[model samples]
Target chain A: MATVAGHPETPLIEPVDRGEGLGHSIVRALSHAPLTILLAFIGVMWLVPTLGLFFTSLLPASVISSEGWWTIFSTPSNATLENYRNIFSDEAITSALLTTVWISIGSTILPIIVAALAAYAFAWMDFPGRDWLFIGVIAMIVVPIQMALIPIFSLYDRVHLFDTLAGLILFHTAFGLPLAIFLLRNFFVGIPGELLEAARIDGASEIRIFTRLILPLSWPAIASLAIFQFLWTWNDLIVALSLARSTQPITVAIFTQLRQFGANIEIIAPAAFLSLTIPLVVFFAFQRYFVQGLLAGSVK
Target chain B: MTDSSITAEPPNQGAPPTADEAGADPGRRRRFLVALGFLAPALVFLGVWIVYPTVYTVVRSFYDRSGDAFVGLDNYGTLFTTDILLTAIRNNAIWVLVVPAVVTAIGLVFGVLTERIRWSVAFKTAVFMPMAISMFAAGVIWHIMYTQDPSQGTINAAVRVVSDAVNPPGVLSGAAPSGDDLRGSAAQGYRLQGELKAGEVAHLGLTRIPASEVKDGVQAVVPATVEGGITGVVWRDFKPGGGGTAGEVEDGEVGIPGVTLRLTDASGAEVATATSGADGVFTFPDVGDASYRLGIASETFRESYGGVSWLGPRLITPAIIIAYIWVWAGFAMVVIAAGLAAIPRDVLEAARTDGATEWQVFRRVTAPLLAPVLSVVFITMIINVLKVFDIVLSVAPPSVQDDANVIALAMWRTSFGGVNDFGLGSAIAVFLFLLVIPVLLLNVRRFRREA
Candidate 1:
């Protein structure tokens, strides 16, 4: 075992620097400062608006109108949780929130899975028309979503998917798959081809190689895709407005307040803030993945 | 490592079944299936939604309001001749020219500036914060700011402060004082007693005091007998290098101060004022295709700069510059940041060994490598700017929307806004699509090459 570890031949490894003690600490700290600040700024910027909205949601409707949310800190003694209570108490908002959760989760999971499989084939599986197929997919990004809305609405109406959650899910999944595959395919292409080829030589099937080698190797890409898909679908109002019936998403639900004449800032500020809560959480949880994903297609 | 590994993996593992020995071709079969699977979903979605609607919009432009009967190029003809659509087109041109240029300009500048700042991330995120809030949401914010009549609105209140300051007691109560008061004042300074009364003739100085002396919004406040207090105060809007002739007041009564008019002698000599009605409507009476000076004013205060000044507010230029700045700065910042991060440390060490200054290393070595990212950023920003719809749509009011709209907004109005004329809408949409096809092609080409 010792001989195996030492292997006097030692594979002629390249000498690596492991700078020591205080020098190492200083270098490490200096190297990380830009990223730390970059990340911290992204965090705080994201937090304030979302937090403002959340705080607004917790206060009574009357107070939000008369004063700015910043005033809450100066007069913390007069806070109330009635706005959130009202959201839950009201059947419309609660139902919409649940509807949003279901649609966002379902849409995100479906596209990530499908896009992963498709990306794997494009990246590794050698088939004719693969390049052409990928180009066709990339071309979809140029198709203005506005042009698609009425047509999709008409198509869904005919198919009786017009008012269903399945309809909205299908639309989001379909639109999201192009960019998803485009991004993930690039990431997958970067994977050391030797790893997958090695797995195949060991008697592993294509499916096994995909599940074991490719999918796990592509976790960062997949995580990023999932978060983006989740955020996009959650924030989506256009499709939901055109497709969803009374079973509205949180975005559509908040928009309804936009129409309530002389609409109180209390409801809007809180509702908009509350709506962003899940996205903020998802973003923070996967900040590293999100940043990696953002840099994926552009830099490489 | 490669060939031996392939051999170590038995042929039975990854090797295709030797059915090819039985005269069956695997490549052909795989190609057929791959094409079918890869293209099936995208084709279905895109064909139904994108291709069909795009084709539909082109076809619809031929029909009338009902879209039932074919009337070829009548819509185009109407678009050319009709005053309203012409106004809409003019406005849209203003929008297209201004919004993208302004947003991209602002975005790029800010994007670059913030990179040098200590708390750049904070500032970048602050400016980029509006991007996260959907356009409609931003509209809500701006809508509150621009809400008219409610002195509480940000812009209206700011305007009122200037209005009160300029006019002193009563600004809008009585009609504007005639040009005679201005001429009479110059005469008074010259010690000439000239009683200028209504319907009375008086000789006045024509010294041609260069107009620069009168600043825009610099109003004359005079004491009045009535409760409204300020009366008969003339508004001298200073315009320089306009080449616009002095206003000739039309036969009709002036609606507002500083409005453009066409004054003609009884023998019908022509004179045109550069200023327009409160509606910003300029008359081109008998002026036989000559250049003219126009002075326009806005009391609107930009949020970035507090208070207000009625500087030379060109009808379209300022708006374009503003929108361009807002969008591009953030894009440049993100791409430059990425480019900076990707610089390999060993390359910097090599530069250091060569005795290069840090500035030299950055300029000579770092910037060259960032070229690829910079091109991608520039191309993408151009495309994004070209397709800009939301900022233009939200910033301008509906009344002015028709006149100050972009192609994207015009397309929306034709299709969905009250008229519901799908055919014309489709035509406009298709035209917009054609405008962007080159950008899209470049984007795809870049994606393929860069990716």
Candidate 2:
């Protein structure tokens, strides 16, 4: 909160400075108008293609092939939900959705449980070689999953984790741990020491102190990190592509179908919407926690 | 509170042990055990999944395709020698050089612009929407935009819409004459049959322009000509009929309008030139009553504004990279905006009050202040781009996948994607790892410094 910002404080009438009087809202708007316009353009530029995709998916497939999504505005009656119907009926996509949901949820739960414990230990426990160990774990964040891909493929083949949902959960958990541990440990380190001290005075064990004292205080951080981990694992394609066989995540299924035949707009458009909507919904629902988690790591 | 905790000694600091804390020294060992227990699961996964595989890949890079034979350095050799892999390496090099800076720059722009804006939250949310979708999904959306057909592709359709109004394409799209009456020479399309009498009507049947593309029921206007001038009707001679005479225009056939034909004498000397009318009829003015051949000018038949070949081999890499930017530029914006939010308003305000323009403030003050966050974003993007796989694989069509291949996708293809050459895959994995190490070390150093 005390981080130095690049803009200077200006003399402004705070709302509370003059109760029932004018606030700084209008003055602030006038001052920041140009920058707001720039940001507005950038935001629209970013969203237009996605908006096009969404609108295009809503229109009937026959309309989609011959006209741009922009045409829907001119001829509003042409839109339909047939694309969604097509996607929902596909057996392959449904199974892929199930696999993706299980993988995302599994990856999220496993990492949070394991990372919370490890992060608590790293933050509070006076363990031998803790810095070296924590540093090593943090360093793994930079080692991309690609480096381990080929060998892991062979390893999965040997161990029978190949083509299994458990295999994906395990891989996602391992990758998720570094950031989870880093973010959680940093958050855990900042907890008021008096809470732990009071628990200690009550003759509580370390487990009791951690569970009773730290976990409740760490919920906001934990929630945000979970959203991040879940979003990543859910939207992942490379890991699923490398590790899974027989049962594939939705991303990989979309990839294979699009690659094999990209011509099917009714299928690809709706399948894409189905794939993106889940994470986007998860994202919007937890917007505060997501931003809190992102800023927690960066605000340092 | 944190400062107090860091400075204040614990209540039990002076005592070795109390009744409730008996064997506290041995408890150090117990604490270590507890820490070890907590850390075990993650370590096990990391060791099996990351550390061991990394070392194995490094060693496996030395072997041959099957991983059974011990062929030291040959896999590494093939990385340099193989055409596809070398192209992959070269393409990865381009990707590494380009994508990170571009994404980070955009992120920086949005981040700084939204700093003082009232609607920054909504703007940031909108920009970050792409970050929610998988790169595969982004690729799908862009595949729709980059389709070869203009009617289906959003980008090309937009281009066609805008370009058609401002710069309408010339008539007579690269169509040519067909049949025995007029045959093409190396220089001109469809030279006149045998020899030409001065006043004979020349009928040159053409193909390449289908009957449906031509305008129907258009009357031919043959301009009046003086003595010894050539007159011709160069319409789309073929009809919608399943079969027809080769060089004769039938009912409902339309003219190949705006075509220009030339008169060449026996010695190939230039004569007069006349452009075809809107209805494919043309007349050259007075000539000295000499025999001449009317040949179609190649320029007359050539078409302009063929839509951009987004999936062609030449443009495939950049096209896919555009899709990548469409997805990731938003990611960059969101992350950098987080960093931007942490910037105090005082510095930028001071810079602006000191009479610096907005652009100057951005470049000198704001950019320098954002260096830490910008570096973090840049380094992370560099690492991500080095291992880029899914976008390239999904976005680039099979015809041009080799051109758009990055090391990570290349590695997949070499090993599990039909080629099944683990050694080559391992080498690529190792190569990618080595390439990422410097920036990874830079990032680790930054994080450590921040910590």
Residue range B312-355, candidate 1, lDDT tens digits? 22232244334344334454555456555555656756664665
Candidate 2 residue-wise lDDT, B1-451, digit = tens: 1111111112222112223334577776776797788788878877887889889999999888877889998898999999999999899888888998999988886676666677778987887777778888888788778876676677787788787777665455556557766778524555777777666777766777755556642644333443576687777766665475666666656676767688888898878777776677888766656778778866564444558889888988899888888777766787777666555666667665665555555566556556666766776678778878877877788778888878888888888788988888888888888887786565455445444
Q: What is the C-alpha RMSD of each candidate to the true structure, in Å?
A: 15.5, 7.7
Residue range A1-300, candidate 1, lDDT tens digits: 101011122122223343344533443454456655764654464345334555555567666555445556888865787776666787877788899899999899987777777776777665556677777777766655556554565568799988899889878887787788777776777677677767766968666777888888878778877877887788777678766667698777766776566665566555666666677577656655655555554311
Question: Which candidate has the top score in lDDT?
Answer: 2
DockQ of 1: 0.11
What are the fnat scores of the candidates, in the order listed?
0.07, 0.46
Query: For residues A261-282, what per-residue lDDT tens digits would candidate 2 score against the true structure?
Result: 5367777778888889998998
Docking class of 1: incorrect
lDDT of 1 at A166: 89
* Segments in model 1 whose C-alpha atoms lie over 4 Å from true places: A1-70, A198-205, A244-247, A297-300, B1-27, B34-43, B46-67, B71-135, B138-332, B345-368, B385-410, B447-451
Alpha carbon deviation, residue B301, candidate 1 (Å): 22
lDDT of each: 0.53, 0.74
Steric clash count of candidate 1: 35
